[model samples]
Structures are given as C-alpha cells and as structure tokens.
Target: MDTAGFTNLLTRPGPYATVLADVSQDSDNAAHAKELRVRAACEELSAQGAPPDVVAEVSDRLAANVRLPAPAARVVVATPEGVAYDQVAVAEVPNQVATWDPLPDLGSWIAARDSSVSFVLVLVDHAGGEISLWDSGLPRPTSTTTVEGDELEHVQKVQDDVGWAAYRMQQTTDNVWRHNADKVAEEVTRLVRDHGHDLVLVGGDPHSVSRLRDVLADQPVEVVELESGQRAADGGEEALHDAIRSALMDRVVRQRTALVRRLEEAWGRGDRAATGVRDVADAFVTGRVETLLIDPDALAGRTLDPADHPGLTFGEAPVSGPVEAGEALVAAAVLTDAQVCVLPASVLGDAPVAALLRWA
Candidate 1:
C-alpha cells in the first residue's frame, strides 16, 4: 500500500528531538516519552498542512483512550481522554472512551467486505508490556483463547503447531532487552497455529518485537506490528484497522492493473476503434462489443452518432437513432453488464475508447 507516503505524513519536526532527550535523561520517562512522541507526530502532521480532519486522525490514533469510528477519513485523538470526529471537513460529536470491545468494530469491518468468507488471526506480544494483534476476514472474535507459561516455551510450541507462521508477524520491537521477550514470541507463534488466520499483527516494545521475529524467521504469514503497548482485547480495533487498510490497498492495485491490461489488449487488436463519442456510441448500438472502457474526462464532452454501427443487433423493427454520446455508451454498457474501465487521462492517451466490443 503506499505506506511510505502515509508514514511521511506522520513525520514531525521537534517532537523526536525532545522525546529522545527525555528518554536519555530520565529512567521514568518511558510513558512520558511515548506521549511526547505521539504529540510530536501529530504536530508534524498538522504542520504538513494535512487537512484539519487528517490531523485529528493522527491524534486519535496516538491516543489509547478513544476509539475512533470505522471507515473514517479523518479523526482527532486526545491522549487518555477520548477521540473526536469530523466528516470531510465537518466535525461531528465525539464519543466517550469506554471499555475495549473488539466485537462490534470487527463486525463492522467484515460487513464492509464484498467477499463471502475470510480468515483472520490476532497476535499479541505482551513481552514489552504491550498488546498487539492482526485481524483479517471475519470481524468479532470467532474464538478467544489464551496461553500462559514461560513466554519463549509457549511461542516455540505455537511455532511447532503453526509451522512457519511467524514471518508475517509485524516486528514491534527492534531490541531484545524486554523481560520475557522470548515468551511473547512463542505465544504469537502459538496463536497463528491455533487460529488459521491470513494475517498476523504483533504489538509491544521495540526490543520484544525484534526477539520474536528472530524466533520466527521462516514463517509464511504476513506480520504487522503496531507502535503501542499490550492492552488485552483493546488491541483488536487497531489490528483490524491496519488489516483493512492493507487489504483495500491490495484490492485497488489489482483492480487498476487488470483494467489497464484489458484496455491495452483491446487496443492492440487494431479492429477496435475509439475516437469521438459518436463513433463509440455507434459501435455499442449494434451487438459488436465485448467490454466497454470509458474515460470519465472523455464522457464530459461527447456527441452520439446517428447511424447504427457494427457489433450491435437490435430486434426486428429496430428504432435506429443517435443517443447522447456519453449517456448512450454508459447505458449500453450497463444494460449489457459489459466490463467497464474508468480510465484517467494517462490511459486515454493510449486508448481513449470505452468498450472492447467485438473485433472489427
């Protein structure tokens, strides 16, 4: 998903520098450090001229107290207080910070999907005193189970059962200095095996996450780590949000590529032609079309042809006449349920045509 761009959005100017100083100057600065870092991150985003709504989003994410709404384009988070909401540019009433309930949010996430069934796995790393998990497919915990013991031993057992499921687990910690780091890694492995999930998320201190990754270097699952502490069931919402974002990004890329390929192939046939709206409209009136691809821009100004063209076959006593170029093409495509590609200007340069109707 172009996370790099999103990550850049979180970058701030002075927060890191001040936070680093606190981390070095005081032993009790851990929590304070996190708060400062989060604040700094938010400030950085605000400075970038991110819409006020987007800025609020970063704030809400950094605050553990509030649960932001699902499918939010922008959110405002207040540390240990709660979250605020806005739509596009209009702000909405904020919700209170309540006990962590992953079920409802999970359900909402799943309902948004067009797919029938999906598998999701949640991985929590309490080693660094943080909880993190990845949720994909199926909202609401279908099953909740726990394992307790020496962290390392438990994670090893999980790995043995899951058979290389740790690779996709996000590395939350980069250091191995956390207490029971090994145990956290073991538990993560166990969770993956017990629940046949498609995605794995790891949450905890940097050190703890590093150790866990080292233990599960060969796993095949997709792992993601969050920059927060373990908080029981609360981590579910965050994990689900990350998984949804990841899934959506992948779907968009795949759809865009497929559409482009179909258009290119049709253009290569040479038999197909797309010029002004009239030419394309004539082709659709007859049954000589297979797929229709339209450039939203092209649709803005186009005129239909009067005469019926190739590929279209009307019933007996056909009423032949010109239709509004853009409207006619869209109507025909919809009526036939033909594949439609909404191309941008760049794609239009190569093929400004709509449907890949029949070959000339």
Candidate 2:
C-alpha cells in the first residue's frame, strides 16, 4: 500500500529518464522505449566501472515488475469506545500482526482502516462468554457472552482451543453436550450481534457448535462448524489461516473479478479500433489511460520489427523507426502494471473490459 520505496526508485535519474520517454501517444511504444532505455542504462553503468553485481542488481530492479494494488484489507472492529480486545500474533504465522486497540473514536477507526486487514477478529466479553468473532470483510460484530471457561489459559500455554475441548468430550461421560451446546449458542448469537457478520464457529467442541446451530435454526444468520478442537486464539497455524480466509472472502472475490474483466477486454476485440484497444491506446498516448490491460500469453510469443515502420512522429518531431508494435504494447502495459491486469482468456469473456480498466 505504501509506495515510498518505489517512488524513490522512479525519481532516480536512471529510471526517470526511461519513464519520461515512455509517456507518449502510443503507450506500447512508450513502454518499449522505456525498457530499451533501462537496458541501455544498465549496460552503460556496468561498462563504466560499476561492479558486475551492482549492474545485475540494477537490471533486476528495472526489469518487469508487478505493482501492488491499493490497501483494501482494512477491518474495523467496533467495541465500546474504551474497551480493548486481547490480541496476540502467533509468531509462526507470517505477514500477520494482531493487536487489540480500544475502539476510541472515528479517528481510531480511520487509523485501523489503513491497515488493510484481511479479516477482523473481535474479542468480546459478554454475559454469555468471551468469544472471538471472525468476519472476512470488516463487517460489524454481533453477540453477548454469559459462560466462563473452567480455567483461563495464558496465551503461551495454549496450543489448540478446539482440540482441548475434544479431549474433554472424549473423557467425559456426563451430559457435557448440553452444557457446551448452550454456551456455544449463546456465544455465537452474541458474536453475530456484535460483529454484524456471518459466523464460523471454531473450537474443540463439536457438540458445542452443532447444538448451537440447532438452536439458531430459526435465526437469519448462518453458522458453520469447523471440525477442529482448537481454541479461539491458540488454534495454531492452520486455524489462523482458516480464520483469515473466512474473513477476506468478499474482498478476494471482488479483486479476482476485476482482474478477469481487464484481461478479457484487452484481448477480446477482433479489430483494435472496433474492439476499443485503439481507443484505449489513444487514451494511453494522451495520458488519459488510468489503467492498461495485456495478455501475458499474447506477449510471450510476440516479436516486434522496429525497422518495418518508418518515422513515427511524437509531438511535432519525427522519431526514428526501430520499434516493434508488440514491444511497444508490452512496455505500455508494464509501465502501468499498477493499473494493469494480465489475465487469462476465460476471465475476459465473462467480464466487462472497460469497466475493469477504469476500476483499476
């Protein structure tokens, strides 16, 4: 989401020169020209006493790159303004940081919004019990808690919450089923109320979630039971992934749909002008193109013959020929990789190309 480092690279003379030259009426042309300039620069630097390693590094940096999309994973967990959820990040999981903050004000919500969280995990204490509610998008929390664990396990000592419950079930012969079921139902209902999202119940208790489902059969909410005996916060590595996936389903689908459309439009038209690729290219030339689309397959086998075309005019002057059309298009697409989608053929047919391009 932060492009500070990339921006610095672009501002450097070596890269900026190529970028500036590539901005023209023909985006593909511009892209090809930029790539040429970059390659040339790397060669010159290497020849001018730069270390081989340094030249290779420069070349690698300047080569084909994919731009990351804007941060959209923000999840806002709304609780009482002063309440803080107990949050911890399991070290074994990569690219995940978990912390609980008091939902103090709109400012805090906005600050949290910047995080691009895949899912929001809300830890709430209610009259029923303490439970963690998971929502893929930043949906609101719903629920109340009334039950208490027989013993409170510290974060480090716990490995699997749901597993522990399963162990208990296997050992007990009493009507623990009814007791656990009541508790799960109460906790799930409260979770739905607090988070305002659908529920995926996880824990060591199968009877608990199953019973909870039967009780909530009349409610509008959907409840899914996972067959793990893991605890809410200590469900180990696999559980963590499961929870995050459930929370980010909506966002993931939306992103995938947009990508498919862009790719389809780029390769769909039989004629460039009629299919709108020409118009899109013209937009790129005028710097009106906010996004570009290219087919990776189309690029792989393509070759350009710069010598085939004579002088190509830019502004008021004629630029020498020697540019291949395919090369130019590839360059243009790469230049706007942040705004480009290299999609498969299937995605293109089912999607709206122009809309996806604009969205990008």
Query: Could you tell me the C-alpha RMSD of candidate 1 in Å?
Result: 18.9
Specify the highest-lDDT model's number.
1
Displacement of residue 206 (Cα, Å) in model 1 is 20
Give the range where candidate 1 is weakest over 10 consecutive residues by summed lDDT.
14-23
User: lDDT by residue for model 1 over 112-200, one digit each (tens)?
Assistant: 22122223333444433332333232234445545342333222326564544453232322222344555655655666677554455
Worst 10 residues of 2 by lDDT: 15-24
Off by over 4 Å in 2: 1-6, 13-53, 56-233, 246-250, 258-279, 301-338, 349-360
Model 1 clash number: 42
Clash count list over all predictions:
42, 49
Residue-level lDDT tens digits of model 2 in 1-360: 111112222222221111101111125664575467556655655554544554454444444432312122211111212111111111111111211111011111112222233222322221123455433223333333436533332223235687776656555523444555566566566656665555344445444545556777876564444434344456464764565555455454555576554445545643221122444444444344444444433333333332332221222112244332333433333344324433443444422222233332
**For residue 203, what is the lDDT in candidate 1?**
50
Give lDDT per model, in order: 0.42, 0.37
